[model samples]
Target: MPRHPTFTLRPLHAALCILLAGPAGAQTLPDVVVSANRQEQQSFDAPASIHAVGQDAIEAAGPRVNLSESLNRVPGITVLNRQNYAQDLQLSIRGSGARSPFGIRGARLIVDGIPATMPDGQGQASTISLPSAQRIEVLRGPLAQLYGNSAGGVVQVFTADGPERPELRMSVDAGPDGLSRYGLQAAGQSGAVNYVVDVSDFQTDGWRENSAAERQHLNAKLRWDASEQTRVTVVANVFDQPVSGDPVGLTRGQMEDDPRQAVANATLYHAGKDVAQRQLGLVLDHRLGADASVMARVYAGQRDLDNRLSIPLFVQTAPTASGGVVRLDRQYSGVGLRYSRRLPAGDGQVLFSLGLDHERMGEHRQGYINNLGVQGDLKRDEQDSVHSTGVYAQADWAINEDWSALAGLRANRVAFRVKDAFITGDNPDDSGTASFSATNPVLGITRHLSADTNLYANIGRGFETPTFTELAYRADGSGPNLGLGSASSTHAELGLKTRLTEQQRLDVALFNIASRNEIVVASSSGGRTVYANAGRTRRSGVEVTHSAQWTPEWRSLLALSTLKAQFAEAFTSSGGAVVAAGNRIPGILDRTLFAELAWQPRAWAGFTGALELVHRGSMVVNDLNEDRTDAVTLFNLRLGWQQTVGAWTLRETLRVDNLTDRAYVGSVIVNDGNKRYFEPAPGRQWGLGLTATYRF
Candidate 1:
């Protein structure tokens, strides 16, 4: 579980306002603050690439218990766990932007601000339940061009608002296949109104073999304050899952000799699968005074899925052949709207926004067979639709006191439609169409050489469009190639933020990205696979982070990342040789590393530990490199504890994954030549958890 990176919380809210303004009138650590560039500024004064993850370092890491695998260990991004719990999941951030086979395209997922993907980007998010979240922001390149047709970046989630007392929480967990989990939460306030609620449930018995799973979750929040410039907020969520579709793909020496036999579930296709989701949201924050303020939001969502497969006819010769069945169904809907404003020059601050979105999708299929008993039938239907509108504005100028600058622009208009029907042979029916419009831009710079140090630079541009199974999958008969366009990128970065004293702190970044057209999914004619628009690709990266508090009961954190992707021209297949140009752009993973350590000792006790390392390189499954795979490494561990008596409070955790049961293979798989690959990365697993809280 990874992919969910791009963070920025204004450096942990400037280190919690310098630990709550202590150290006698603290004044450094503040050149500009941020609300994700909607207003409030600083961070090289905004231009893009934001990243933040706090809430006490996400409760001291604890190997992130959900919430998209705790943002998939931050850093550029990559998260693909097609199996091993949480049924079928995938996410990518740089490479694999619009050629998704199943791995949500070009990222863009938000919570609180609503818009949980769904506009052909297809997003379910495993029913997000992060125990009252309070922080998680990641806005990549071009600041994601104000959330519209993302080209890979933007995952914002924020919950747990209005607090100063009243609280309650509970949790429990169990592990090792047959796992179990439960959770509950509550928040409070009265007079001016404020509230929060959450619930969760999870179960698993999977590791292949008819894969079993069960999940349920709900979240809610409300806030109101009629007087003093008015304010209103509301949010809701619901998710459910009941799955059992074991499509095991294994390789890597049979998963290093058995990762539960790499799942296939005793054949017969192993059927049964169901998934559901629902969401609702509303917001209005007014303060028509004090530098002006007005915010509005509306949202709606729904999703349903079903699958069943079974096949078996003449296996090991003909003993009177018999058996076959297939079924699938899917549906989705979405709506959204937004508006924002903020102005007050002088030291700097200016922001603006407008938005609208719509989405719809549907699919159906059926098949049957029973030889010896004689029976056969087949039917299929599909549909897709999407519409979008957007407008944006940004500014943050402070040409004094350490310089600052920022700029923004966004304009989008889109529409796409498709329909299809079939029944056996004789060219049943088909239909398709397409549309597009795009505009994205951004710029940035900041310098505040003192007060703890700061320096920044930025450049931006982004775009993406084309999904709905890449404009109606038709594969073998060609046709359905809607003059592909949209798929562009241009990004640059140079950064540094420091406080290297008083408990240490550091952040560094250097990035580069370039692209053009670049939308691939080859193999046409009879064998299927369409959607093209390739040529050009380049990516460069580096990130470093550090945190400290050596004494006072220890505290530590360290992170490192490096990446390189290439391919800038050269093509000719369809049996024509050629095909070359830097290569190596397949499942990106040059290196990654993470570390953690903690100890509180009093003030409610505390203890934490963690470690992670991964390096994946050497790809090329087909772009005509003739299959390739080699390069792997993995490790993980965690332990945690918390305490507090009186009103009640307790927490505990212990986890060990891989831990030496090594055997990896996770670089986003989807190359059905039948040699089956991708199935490793699960062994020697363990988990145990407990949590409780209360107050009034």
Candidate 2:
């Protein structure tokens, strides 16, 4: 007997942008345009879980340095600021990516319709430029599976278009712990072309011992009307971080004694990382007919990385050891095309979309011994590459006046190849190749309950494959784990969107997911880790969001998420420890809540103020659930003032975080073999910012 999968998903932009615009006593929420279904559609009518963070929310009294600063407000999404910039933030959706060792996996990241995530299903958010961003959209649940491999969710960032009139803006921000940022932006329209350019530099000096970092970013965009029915856009960006110190994690006792202290080995090894990246892309859109259109995009990028780890000196002596210092020069590129058409139906119309995506990444990887802060003799070298291709088709039908249906299918294939360059006496040719493929399908339906209420449900399949890093070693230290299998999942979701009153809106969703051959760490020793397939795992969650405009000057928002993620079958972990069937997944909180109250007065010179509260439940550090972080609650406050005179505009902002000065763990390292798992959150901190703009 085949078991049917069942689940529920939430709404689109449910709690954001409700009061960003509109008059003092507006009765209806503003309409938002989203690309959740690979087309521009009203979010209120979309049958998926999606949210958009606008420019106002992203730039509100914040440094605009990290995505974690603004993503916390979205329900069912978690952005853990490690504070150690060398490792990047840890992001997860509904517990899907909780097991990541570092960086991002189990999700797809897109910037300007170009994939930020590599074909191997790994990504870093450090390259994003927030200063010139217009909006960020997050999509979750079954519909997200249409994006292909590791599509536990999808996050996309879009750059703002140029202004109608020429303008120049400069901003400066300063804070405690030697934190500072300087930014410049220029935007204007000239003839048939519109352009926007931004540059920024940020630095921080030791928020914790041995944790200093500096970075610079440059972003540019240009758009033009190529023909009467065609438009073209070009985007380019660069990111450079010469160095960022890695403090690593601390033990429970070490955190209790002093939360700001770095691990002893981290200082001894001088752990750190250096990164540089540049990318360019082009997009073209053309109208084929009154009810038909076509879009195409091409992008390419290169990244250079040098990372130093805290592995002991003796660990490098082993024949199979890959050394403590790592270097990588990587090149990635992709191309995409989509065509959409509308056909007449009995009562409404059927919208059809067809698309194709192809991407590839190649890397020159090397390893060297870390002799203190310097690199020693080479220990390993290899050339690795991955290629991914996907084809999909979708249809949306307005079955009747009160009902709608959506269906989509996608086929994907990923191939990985490695060639060994360091074939020493003891290390034979460790090169290997592997390939994985999957076909995913999704179906959704929407029922109109009333003029102000909608009910939706969807179901789909998802797939994930092991990355080059995960397959780098075998549990027995033989060679690459080419036998490791991929993971597949079934997802289902149900949701409700309703307006409780003229000024209040509510969104609720429930979802369930089950996976087979789930990936897990089989063992970890020295600087190497091996992975294996677990029997089964399950994740179930509920999300709710409420937004209300009490008056013209008062607004409130609330977002809540609760998830239960666990192993569905018993499994053995590192050191032969049996993980019980019901053990909670490591590094994922069971519950989280965010609430905010904002105020603005027309008579106070454009003054605005807001108070925010955040709460998180305790999370286990390892698969055994033997150790956990403490639950915590935090408060934040922000105030802003703006004044305009003639052609000049000036704005000032003040922000305070962790207002109660509570000490807590911000994040945890899952399944760390050495028992160093805790990353402590900072105490009370404040920042001030000033901006000036001129119109010509």
lDDT of 2 by residue, 105-139 (tens): 88888888888889988888899898899988888
TM-score of each: 0.32, 0.95
lDDT by candidate, in order shown? 0.60, 0.86
Stretches of candidate 1 off by over 4 Å are: 1-87, 90-102, 105-142, 146-148, 151-209, 212-269, 272-377, 381-401, 408-430, 434-503, 506-546, 549-555, 558-595, 598-684, 687-696
Ten residues in sequence with the least summed lDDT for candidate 1: 315-324
Top-lDDT structure, candidate number: 2
Q: Which tens-of-lDDT digit does each residue in 604-657 have in candidate 1?
A: 556655565444444445555555555554566767787789998887888776
* Candidate 2: Cα lDDT at 509: 89
**Candidate 1 TM-score, true structure as reference:** 0.32
Clashing pairs in 2: 7-492, 7-493, 7-494, 8-492, 8-493, 8-494, 9-494
Which candidate number would show the highest TM-score if scored against the true structure?
2
